[model samples]
Target: MEENDVLVTVEGLSKKFCKDLKTSLWYGIKDLISNIQGNKNERLLRPKEFWAVKDISFELRRGECLGLIGHNGAGKSTLLKILNGLLMPDAGKVTIKGRVGALIELGAGFNPILSGRENIYNNGAVLGFTKQEINSKLEDIIDFAEIREFIDMPVQNYSSGMKVRLGFAVAAQMEPDVLIIDEVLAVGDLGFIMKCFKTIDNLLDNTAIIYVSHNMPTVSRLCDKIILMEKGQSLFQGNQVGKAIDMYYGSFVENESNIVFTNGSIELLTIDLLSSLKMNDNIHEIKWKDDLLLYFKFKLNLYIDIPIFRVLLYDKEQRPLAIFEPNYDENLLKNNNGFLEFTIKHEGIQLSKGIYSINVTAFKRNSNEPILRINNVLSFQIIHDEDHFQPFLLSSTFSTK
Candidate 1:
């Protein structure tokens, strides 16, 4: 791409923060004096100072979207703030070719005491829009936000969702050259979020965007380039969005088993993934079409007839995606020498490529009461060539004329 095509450019961008307020003030005074004396050293870290963002660089061309993803406090927000001109980088520079619109934080650009209507005009003027332009887009913004009735109300009274909706509507409707969005969109309801995404899709053709989010599906849907960050450093940056997403998912520490409810009659001795290959003691790796087998051993304190066992699969977000319940068979539930041992086998697993966790529940046959309910008993990953947003990857035939 030509240089002129690039709408946003960042080079060696770095920012640091001091952990102690008193120390920070002292350092600030010293730095000011050093700069006045023409001997400032911005790169050196003082005591209690840490780099929040360090040496991160990327270029955004018009019509391209970059996904900035990481765990909380990974400096994604700090990078966005620098790009949006909310904060200046101590060691690098950022250049933008056009007007920038940002919704980095909920109610960030709004005056809390001002009505939404007045704030809209203020934000528009900040973006260099004339009164005529703001008037032309006012109705569209109010309608898109779905807050027409509350447009005249003070912004401080708006709920988080309301603020997100209004903030996004104003930012998106103005259609600035560079748009920066943070995870504030996660606060909106599902319906409004869909609407906001549709607006983003429409805006992509004429704008360059920097989107920071933890929702992998949305990132996969929108971003053409991905950057994986950890500890304020970019661990991976490339067009291999799927691989970047995998790394992000890999960084998550498996949740420890949380027993929601349990009876004294049953004790879970061990649960293991019966696999030839293992990622670690806690995680197993398998191909997409491979059979998944889970072995369970439970000590039976009291002999209960026909105990029912259930296995639930959950995505990385902890949303339950699938459930497995074996057919009723008295022989399968029988106690073997004071212990219950069995294997739950899933033939040709159809789940899409991603990390998943297992949840197990045991109950008395035909009873609603659970003998044991446990979460995050086991975790696993399915390797696949392609990433999918849906939970299942079913086999289907395709044809074209």
Candidate 2:
């Protein structure tokens, strides 16, 4: 790689976690005793280690957007924390060519008790920005977040969405050489999200983005490369974004068999589509007006009165478009299976011929709500006929009618 091209290099990076509660408690006491005894190794009782990230190596070049994808608890966030200097790897090393800016959590370093303006200064200082530098960017940050009126209020008083907007605005304006983002795209309103994407797009010329998101379409559009990670191991690493996405989806499907949960009395047995589904050239194609059906089978180990289920749909931009619940009565008592299903039909959606996600939920019939909820539960694409020949996007002309 050219001298300027190579931005970040990670080598043999490994992070181990401890699983034993008693051992952890013992170690804590031992450390206290060791501090009194002045013995460094006195507290060291070696317990078995759980490797969250094990011996993963990769090179990220400047101006390249790298998409990191994995299931929950799959070590994606751990890797980002290590890269952002929040956590140190137990083994191996990470080297960066320039200053780092990270958006790991919404309002991560913000003090809840402090005003938004105070937190901005505090966070900016932590990010290596001088007081003078923060002063210069203060107006821009406030303007971008569009929260000028609430700038003097404590961040704890801000709504979840407002906090996300302000936090993202600050991080994006930092203009670091290496930017590490973890699911920040999952926040904010649609207009703010579009603004975030544009800011990221503008930074693509000088920054190396390590983007961790659940939106695959956004990943495909923004990232120059993709990395598929599973169970703390890098499964695939290359510039082939499409193949990596396919691998991610395949892993998701393979792991479906492992979703059998014994925690609650209800168990999700099977989930499948009603219509014939075809994924064409990395794009799922379904008839424009077909109703989306989901078949679900669950076994109830305990007697419960009134179970409720909710199904939701999200556009490619991750906006909630619709929510569905099956029409049922007070007769849904006891545990039965084989004939429970839900359906969704979007009459308001005037798609520009693209893919969309379907989210689902399952709860008790009446008494206790939200038994099981699933997001991005299903996916389908809409295809417009060639002869219809209308601008296929959601615009004034199409939606106004």
How far off is residue 210 in model 2, in Å?
A: 0.7
Clashing pairs in 1: none
Please, what are the lDDT tens digits per residue for candidate 2 over residues 57-108? 9888888999999788888999998998877676788999887888776566
Q: Which stretches of candidate 2 lie over 4 Å from their true place?
A: 1-4, 25-47, 254-401
lDDT of 1 by residue, 1-401 (tens): 45339998889888899999999999889878877897635677777999999889999899899999999999999999888888868888899988787866544458999999999888767656799988999999899889999999999999989988887777776667888888777888999989888888998888898999999989988999889988788999988888898888878747588888899778889998895276754578888888998899999898677577888999987888989975467675667888988888989898888889999988887775789999999888888888887878997789996
Give lDDT for model 2. Answer: 0.71
Highest TM-score model number: 1
Identify the runs in model 1 with alpha carbons over 4 angstroms from their true place: 1-4, 33-42, 106-115, 154-157, 275-281, 326-332
Looking at model 2, residue 266 earns an lDDT score of 62
Q: What would you estimate as the lDDT of candidate 1?
A: 0.84
